[model samples]
Target: MKHLAERARQVIPGGVNSGQRSIPGLTDLVITHAAGARFRDSQGREFVDYHAAFGPPLLGHNDPDVSAAVAEAGRTVDLCGVGVTAGEVELAETLAELVPSVEKVLLTSTGSEATFHALRVARAATGRRLVVKFQGCYHGWHDAVSLNVISAPEKVGTHDPISTGILPEVLQATLVLPFNDAEAVRRAFAEHGDDIAAVILEPVPHNVGCLLPEQEFLETLRAECTRAGSVLIFDEVITGFRHHLGGWQAISGITPDLTTMGKAIANGYPVGALGGRADLMELFSSRPGGPAFFAGTYNGQPAVVAAALATLRKLREEPVHEHVFRLGERIRTGLAEVFASLDIPALVTGYGSVFVGYFMTGPARTYDDLLRNDANMFIGYRRRLLEHGVFELPLNLKRSHVSYAHTDADADHLLEAAASAASLARGDVLDLTDASTMGGADAHR
Candidate 1:
């Protein structure tokens, strides 16, 4: 792994293609191939694959159905000059049928594109400039929604850009606030009701360790957005197909005006979709000079659409959600027990097949609660888990995912690995509550 990382650094900007893979105290593996719930590193070591391609491999790596579908498309479909294939139309129909808030669909090639277009549509439809996004909620890498996904502990409500390239006007247009803070949402709406184009969030925030949305918090956003005439966009890229067939909107019973979906929607394919009320989505149409512009060369590319249709159909027809939910429950229970028995001050937060273990004392309700966990200890624990052949991302402040391919045996192995890792992590003595040692809980629940 180290050798490959070194080689990658010689060509790639920072050894890895993405910044998340370049975390300290870890060597990112160069994977050869993956199947079911395990993948082999370049050195031929197979690890139980809990990373799940950062959430897209919900049905597991190279699922036979998905692979076959892609193969069929490769044989029968064209990559260029196809001009609206049946696969794209079918995939759009499937999305409209399955996702609860989707009355219409506009396909994109990536999650970032989906989010970028959604924001544009919101701004165009409402004739407003400002957008409301909560702290710790990752929409994508676009300049409009780039700030505050993972900022410093002191920068929670400051609308600070996570990256250096974002413009000052972009930061000013975004109203960053704490998650689960209803009063803050109300206050923001009250103050900028006229200027706020949309209020966007991850209904079930997983980027910062599967922070579930409080019912009141979601309801508050819905009510305030309606009152303020602002579009409510749910960035369900990660939670889309992972949580339910209809995404988080189905579970929460509070639908957003626009929903951006990707990642798990296609079960590891490069695809993204923006869907919402027909009126809002129509803003993208060029007919009669529709205000918002959305264009992409690879929008609804045939092979990806084929994989997505197969994945979504399998998710809809089979008992996939039930099986994964059972595994998630077992993990949550087992981790709590492991931490209690080990006498480790920790909190496990998640819903469905997504979870993360934070070295903390109590429940985590917001991004600030998440920031209080000991990063160094968590990093060590993650490294120990990797040593035990459990393949979760080596980052501390991120979520780990389980997939449909993970069996009962895989869950048991994960529990065992976690227990061993927790024990190995005990030697690093650090205060879990001290803000200086651990990032302080900056916001009250």
Candidate 2:
């Protein structure tokens, strides 16, 4: 593993393609392959996967149905960038049918692209510049929304960009506020209502563990955006298709102007979608006087579209949500029991099919409340779980996903591992030399 890590570092920056993939101090795992709920590393160690590739493998890694669809699509169709394919039309129609607010849809290669275009549509439609995003909700790696997620105490209310190269003007255009604070939303809109083009957020901020949005806060956003004529965008890249086929908007019943979706939409295939009212989405049309521009070579690549269609069909036909949601609840309850038995100060929280164990006291309503979390213990416990053949990212506040492929037996095994990991964490027996230094706020999805 160490040799492979070193080899990757020689070619790839930080030994991983994505920044979050590089584990601090520990040598990162070179995953050989994955199927269903388990994956094996280069060292021949098999672990029950809860990471779910950062919430993309909703049906599980290498799901046969999605793979078969991709294979069939490859045989019939490939990328034809100039014209649209039957698969692309099917995907857009399916999204419109499933999502209440989405009358039209646009495909993109990744979630980041979906968000980037969504913002463009919003700005073009409203003729405004500023965008409002919450503190801990991660939209993507884009400059407009890539700041202040999982921030430190000192940087909480300040303009904290996750990366360095973001222009000062880009940072200044975003208004970052705390999640679940309805009053803050009211205040921001009251002060800068006309200037704000959009207010984007994850209905559930899964990136920083699941900080569920308050009803009042969501209502306030809808009302303010409606009154100000600002586009309301729901960045459901994490929550979409995982919680429901229609996304969180279906469950919340508070429709937004636009919705950005990906991650679980394709069962690990690189495909994302931005969908909304026809009036706003038509702005992307290259008509004679269309305001917004949207173009991508791989936007509706055949295989990816097939994979997404297959994944969505399976979610609709099978009891995927029922099974995964049950397992998620089981894991959350079991973890709470384990921590309580060990007398550890921890909180187990999540929505359907997602769970996070935070080493903090009581309910965490906002990112500011999460600052009290025991970062070292959170990292150490997850590391111990990794040793016990339960694979979760060794990053504090990173949530675990329960996929449709996961069974009751898998959940039981994870609970057993969690019990042992919690015991180890309580005893302070794990070597947390580097874990202590890996700040909770630095690593995000």
Would you list the C-alpha lDDT of every candidate in the order shown?
0.83, 0.87
Model 1 misplaced stretches (Cα beyond 4 Å): 1-3, 286-288, 429-445
- Please give the RMSD to the true structure for each candidate, in Å: 4.0, 2.1
Superposed model 2: Cα runs more than 4 Å off? 286-288, 429-445
For candidate 1, write residues 1-445 as lDDT tens digits: 3488688878998677655655454455678888999998787788998877678989999999999999999999777844678988888888899888899998888888888899898888888999988888888878888777666677766877756788899889988888999999999988899999999998877777767788999999999999999999998888898998888999999989999999988898889999999998887863456778878888888899999999998998898989998999899889989998988998887888988888898778888887788887786787788888897776656678888999999899889999999898778654434322222111100
The estimated TM-scores of all candidates read 0.94, 0.96
What is the Å distance of residue 10 in model 1 from its true position?
A: 1.7
Give each model's clash number.
0, 0
Maximum-lDDT candidate: 2
- Name the 10 consecutive residues with the lowest summed lDDT in model 1: 436-445
